[model samples]
Each structure stands twice: as C-alpha cells, then as structure tokens.
Target: MTTRHDLQTRLERGIAALGLQLPAGAVERLLDYQALLARWNATYNLTAIRDPGEMVSRHLVDSLAILPYVQGATLADLGTGPGLPGIPIAIATPEREVLLVDSNGKKVRFLREAIRSLKLENVRAVQSRVEEVEGQFDCVTARAFASLADMLAWGGHLLTKSGIWLAMKGKHPEDELAGVPDGYEVRAIHELHVPDVGGERHLVVLGRTGC
Candidate 1:
C-alpha cells in the first residue's frame, strides 16, 4: 500500500519530469480523488487504477497534462468514469465550471461521491447520456468514452458555436476520425507525452463550423 505522501511525491516528480506545471492545490485534490476512487472502486469499479503509485501516472498526470490546452470557460467531460479529466481539471481551475456526465448509475454515484469528498465546488456530476444533456459548453471532452465520430455527434449540440471538441485518444485514432460526420473540422492534433507512461497518447481537438 502506498501512502498519500508517497503518491504526492511521485506526482510532483512526474509533473516536473514531464515539463508540466500544475495548478496550485492540484496535488491535494488529486490525493482526495485517489482516496475516493479507491473506496468506490471496491464495488462500483470506477477505474482500474487501484494502486496509488499507478494513479499518479494513469489518473493524475494523465488527466492534468491536457490542462494547458483546454482554454475555455465551461467544460464538460462526457462519460467521465469516476471523474477523469473533469475532476482534476475542476480542481486545477476552480474558477472554471465543469460537468462530468455518465450514463452509468454506479459511475455517476462514484463521481458524485468524489465531488463531495474533494469538496469540488466547480464540478457537477450528471447521470445522463451525453446526447440528452443540455448545455452550451465552451469545450467538451471525451476520454476513452467512445469513438471520435460518435462522441462528436453526441456532444456537438452541447458546445458553443465557436467551442472546441477535445477528444483524448490513444495511439492510432485515424480509424475513429474516418467516420466523423460532415460538419465540424479537425482543428488540431496534439500528441501527449505522459510522464512515466508507455505507448502513445494524443488529443484530437475538433471545432464546429456552422453552430
């Protein structure tokens, strides 16, 4: 079992090694997140990252790396299983509002618990399908939630006219983008380098054309 201090140290070192600067209080919030995740995962199975050390790379750092790129007012994390990038992002940018939505009751319960435990005033957990939710978010994120095209279609209506759609994908997402509906345009493709993680990670940023 890893202690909280150990996890924090690993997070600090990983962030420094990745050449990423985290927002103040991020470490503490992530620690709380890890605790809540561990507790809920006992039954809810929110995430596979049961070990604290692994949580640093798989959960904390992996989620935080995208912070520098999402410059928007309101953000939504679609299918956020146990609050991946959403909870971390909310903690990082307390001023920016975020919504974490998932269709699973268990996942949403865990997410709500995490929000309460972390005292994350900026995050709201919604237990509904992304397509059914109503809101105009400046940015909407989908992390390992669904295919690129499917996620875009489901979240398209939730984004502001000029908003961006951020999809955190694994290596080789071209297949997912191939079926994208004709409308939005791929604005940027950012390859993420997660500290101490293997394989390839990428971010696909899409933009709507005609509202």
Candidate 2:
C-alpha cells in the first residue's frame, strides 16, 4: 500500500526535480486526490493502475511533467480519463481555469466528486464528447487519448485562434506528425523523462501557423 507519507515523499522529490512550485497544502490535496481515487477504484475500477506508488510515477508525475510547458489562462483537457493531468494541473496551477472533459459517466462522476472534494474553485467537470463540448479555451490537451489527427479533428475547435494543442504521446509520433491536419502545425515536440517511469514519453505541441 502506498501510504500518504510515502507518496508525499515521492511527490516532493518529483516536484523538486521538475522545478514545480506547488502551493501550500497542494501536495496534501494532490495526495488527497490520489487517496480518493484509490478508494473509489476499489469499487469503480477507475484505472488499471492498481499500486498507489505506481500512480505517483505514471499518473501523477507523468501527468505533471509538462507543467513548465503549459500555457494560457484557460485549459480544456479533452478525453480526460479519470482526470489524468487536468485535475492535477488545476490543483498545481490554481490560476488557470481547467475544464475536465470525458465521455465516460463513471469517470465524469469521479471527476465531479474530486473537484468537489478538493474544493477546486478553478476547475469543473463536463461530461460530453469533445467535439460536442462548448466553449473555446486558451489551451487544449489530450493525453494519450488518440492519434494527433483524430484528436485535432474532434477537439481542435475548442482551442482559440492563438491557442495551443498539447498531446501526450508514448513516443515520437512520426506518422501522426506526417498526418497533421491542415491549418495546424506542429510547433514543438518535447521528450519527457518522467521520474521512476521507464520507456519513452513525449509531448507533442501544435498551434495554428496560418488562418
């Protein structure tokens, strides 16, 4: 079992390594979110990741590794399964307004409960398909949810004219990059090295180069 102290220790190290400044008690709230997730997972099976310690690396650290790159004042995490990076991102950056979008009812409910439980004033959960969801955000993110083309097809409209699209990918998506839709261009590709996580991790950032 991943105790609170154990996760806190690991989380602190990760925050330091990543050069992230989490607000006071934000760590405890993140750990609170983790504990709540674990408790709910016992009955709902929210995620396949069972070990709490692993969640720290794969779910928490991996999700937060891109904090330095996240931009803008508003964000929409499309196809956000169990609020991978959305909830954590909101918790870490309370200044930004975060909308956690997911199609699964269970996950949506979980996100709602988490938001309420965490008392996150800047975050909200929306249950709907990404394309059908309303509102334009300054930034949009889809985490390992789908191919770059497909993700953009569904959620690109949510991004503002100058907004950025960030996608969490397992590796350098050469094929996906080749298939990027028109009007959007790949701006940057960051190779992520999540703490305690093996294997390749990359973050693909896209933006509109032309109208």
Candidate 3:
C-alpha cells in the first residue's frame, strides 16, 4: 500500500523539476483519488491501468504534465472520462473550481465518488455531455476526447470572451487543426515529456479571438 506521504514526495519532486506550484495537501487527495480509482476500476472498467505505481506515472503524473501551461480562473473538463486531467488539475489548484462532465453514467459515478473520497469541494462531477453543460468558463479542457476541430465545436460555447480550450492530443494534430472553427486562435502548441511513457504528447491551447 502506497501511503499519501509516498505520493506527496513524488509529486513534490516531480512538480519542482517541472517548475510548477500546486496547493498543499494535493498529494494526499491525489492518493485518495487513485485509491478510489483502483477500487472502482475493478467493476466499472474506467481505466486500463490497474497498477498503483503505473497509475501514478501514467494517470496522475501524466495529467499534471500540463500544469505549466493552464491559464484560467474556472476550468471545465469536457468528456472527463475517469477524471483524467480534471481531477489532477483540481487537486493541483485547490482554489480553482473545476467541473468534470461526462455522458457515461458509470464514469460519472466513479468521478463523484473520487471527488467525495478526496474531499475535493472545488470539483463538481456532472453527468452530461459537453454541449449540455451551460455557463461560460475561463478554460475548457479535454484529453483523448475528440478531434481538435470537434472539441472546439462541442466546447466552444463554454468559453468566456478570452477563454481558452486546452486540448491534449497525440503526436501530430496537423490534420485535426486544419478545420478549426473561425473564431478561435491557436495560442500555443507544447510538447509533453512524461518521464517513462514513450510517445509524443502535445497540448494545444486555443483562445477566443475577437475575429
């Protein structure tokens, strides 16, 4: 059993190396989330990774890898299946309110349970599609969700005037970016380097321009 202290040390070291700051006690809550995930995964099949250590690197750490670039006040995670970047980001920024939306009932149930177990008051797990979730947000994020253009189309309305869309994608998103809707602008494209995971990861940040 990996204790919260263990995860704390790892998270602290990892974040420091990456040059980022997260709220205190994030490690404990993250560990709690991981525990809940493992327990629920048995029945729900939410995530493919089962090993705790692998979960730390692949799910927890991998998600936090984008911490260096997220800019916003309130964030909404579209298609937050099993609460990937949403849960981790919520833990990192305890002050920022985060909404995790998913259509799958089982995944939403697991997300709600994880939030409760982690005592994450800032996180709201909503069982709904991205389009159904109303209210303008400072940032909308997705991981392994949809094509870049599709993500923009579905989550566009949720963004505030200057709000951003943080879409995490694999190696080449050139084809996907070709069809981006008219009003959004590509702010930046950052490559992620997860410690042990082999593959090219890119974080595409799209901002609303008054075009």
Best by TM-score: 2
Task: Write model 1 residue lDDT over 1-211, tens digit each, in one string.
Answer: 6888888888888778767666777778788888778877887777877777887788888988888788788999998888888888888788899999999998888888788877888889999988899989998888898887788778889989889888898896887777777888888889998987788999998888664
Minimal lDDT window, size 10, model 2: 1-10
Candidate 2, which segments miss by more than 4 Å at Cα? Answer: none
Rank by TM-score, highest first: 2, 1, 3
lDDT of each: 0.84, 0.90, 0.85
Instruction: State the TM-score for model 2.
Output: 0.97
CA shift of 156, model 3, Å: 0.5
Write the candidate numbers in order of decreasing lDDT.
2, 3, 1
Best by lDDT, which number? 2
Off by over 4 Å in 1: none
Pick out the ten consecutive residues of candidate 1 with the lowest summed lDDT: 14-23
RMSD of each: 1.5, 1.0, 1.8
lDDT of 2 by residue, 38-114 (tens): 99999999999989988888888888998888999999999888998998898899999999999999999999999
Q: For each candidate, what TM-score against the reference?
A: 0.94, 0.97, 0.92
Question: Clashing residue pairs, candidate 1?
Answer: none
